[model samples]
Target: SGSRAVTIDTTPPGAPVITSVMDNMGTVTGDIANGGRTDDTTPTLNGTAEANSIVRVYNGTTLLGSVQASGTGAWSYTPTA
Candidate 1:
């Protein structure tokens, strides 16, 4: 009862991938890349179909974050990575 053991994995995960938005029309004001989070800034949605809709951020089809346009017209996210 004087010995202990533990195991850990130290392999770094792959980076997230940024893909084209579905039906993306207007130029995104903030960073549109994967893991990109915007706050207090509205993306220029001149021709965007759904301006105030829940957009899903992903990495090679892996769901990352769901950004929603707030009352202040901004998107916020706290990435775990």
Candidate 2:
């Protein structure tokens, strides 16, 4: 329906942080100009992170939730509204 810019914090090496962020809830529809683009899917989280690392989803400096990283240095998370 609309676009939202997700700010990712990448600082304080000793602390858990976000390296990169993507725009959330963007419009993706199949139309005449787009040719074949559609909005039937969402983004998937799949990556490796350090143990005890915390992944936080935010809406501009507001901490949404904390996701604990796996013991094998892997953390995958999906944010829900």
How do all models score by TM-score? Answer: 0.31, 0.41
Off by over 4 Å in 1: 1-51, 71-73
Clashes of 1: 0
Residues 1-81, model 1: lDDT tens digits = 698787887865333222322222345344454445444233322112133556555559898667664543344443334
Q: Residue by residue across 5-46, what tens digits does model 2's lDDT show? A: 999998654545443333334575322122333243333344
Top TM-score hit: 2
Residue 47 lDDT (model 2): 51
Error of 2 at 27 (Å): 11
lDDT of all the models against the reference? 0.43, 0.53
Candidate 2 all-Cα RMSD = 16.5
Give residue 5's lDDT in candidate 1 (0 to 100).
88
